[model samples]
Target: MAKGKHNPERKAVRHGTEKGSVTLGGRRVAVEKIRVRSVDGVEIPLETYQALQDPELLTRAALERMIHGLSTRNYAYGLEPVGDDVESFGTSNSTVSRRFIAVRQLKST
Candidate 1:
């Protein structure tokens, strides 16, 4: 007899097939798209996205503003005297001194 071609199907057992849609988290919710407009009359589509993946971006923004304010004050008033009244002025004397040193170090770097 001629040998039959290799067929793994003859040695296999049939298993029950599964039929169902896989739901993730919960039932899928339909989201509506939003349209946006620019000053130049351009129509843009806005998508809902997660806020600030990098927290450092926010810190850098605030730090930039703080540095700008400090620089302006230093130039205008020649660095206010660090004394007991510093806290009443919205910042502590030690904190101000630390910030001054940190800025000087940053500039030197």
Candidate 2:
């Protein structure tokens, strides 16, 4: 939401980058965000593009696994291996549980 909110009354003048990280297919990857700039140079990210970068991706993946009978304790085992070069974290049982609860709370609100 921080990067991509747009004002339709304005005209898009150019494209710019907003670097960030996002998880795709269970692997966290770096991304260069594409944004539309107004004549005054105010960057407005594309809604669809920003949605692809939502951090809830990991939470949703964890929830899907839970719905399919994978316990939170086994969450890490469910992710696609990112190899030795990538430092792995955030897949612990407690972390997954917390993420699931957070998402539920957000949905309720």
Candidate 3:
């Protein structure tokens, strides 16, 4: 059998944000990024940070990423799913709303 390949020396990522950044459009932004440690134990922050001022816009963008990921089967959902896969994660409106709130809380925390 063919064994799955993995990165044995891959470093873990640490999430953090740097606030009070100014954009080219004269808008303030809070940067979000992940840090990785090298041999010297020096944390190198990834070059990732964008100015997203609108909360609803950020929420929509995140949801879009999730939906796109599902469509692309990015979560190891395989090229496709079994018959009942989609139905399995189904939730009611209130449940979904609560989950959305929880996700927002995650950003705040």
lDDT by candidate, in order shown: 0.37, 0.74, 0.41
Best by lDDT: 2
Lowest lDDT sum, 10 consecutive residues, model 2, at: 24-33
TM-scores for all candidates: the values are 0.21, 0.57, 0.25
lDDT of 2 by residue, 1-109 (tens): 3568775665776685777666765545666666688677887667776676677788788888889999988887788766656654567788889988998898999
Candidate 2, residue 88: Cα displacement in angstroms equals 6.5
True-structure Cα RMSD, model 1? 24.4
Please provide, for model 3 over 12-84, each residue's C-alpha lDDT reduced to its tens digit, 9 standing for 90 to 100: 5444554333221111233333446654577764453333343444344334545565322232232233343
Model 1, 98: alpha-carbon shift in Å? 0.4
Off by over 4 Å in 3: 1-6, 15-24, 48-109
Question: Which pairs of residues collide in model 1?
Answer: none
Q: Write the per-residue lDDT of candidate 1 for residues 41-99, one digit (tens) a residue.
A: 56543232222223333334334545667442333243333443222231334444555
Most TM-score-accurate candidate: 2
On lDDT, the stronger of 2 and 3 is 2
Which stretch of 10 consecutive residues in model 1 shows the poorest summed lDDT?
20-29
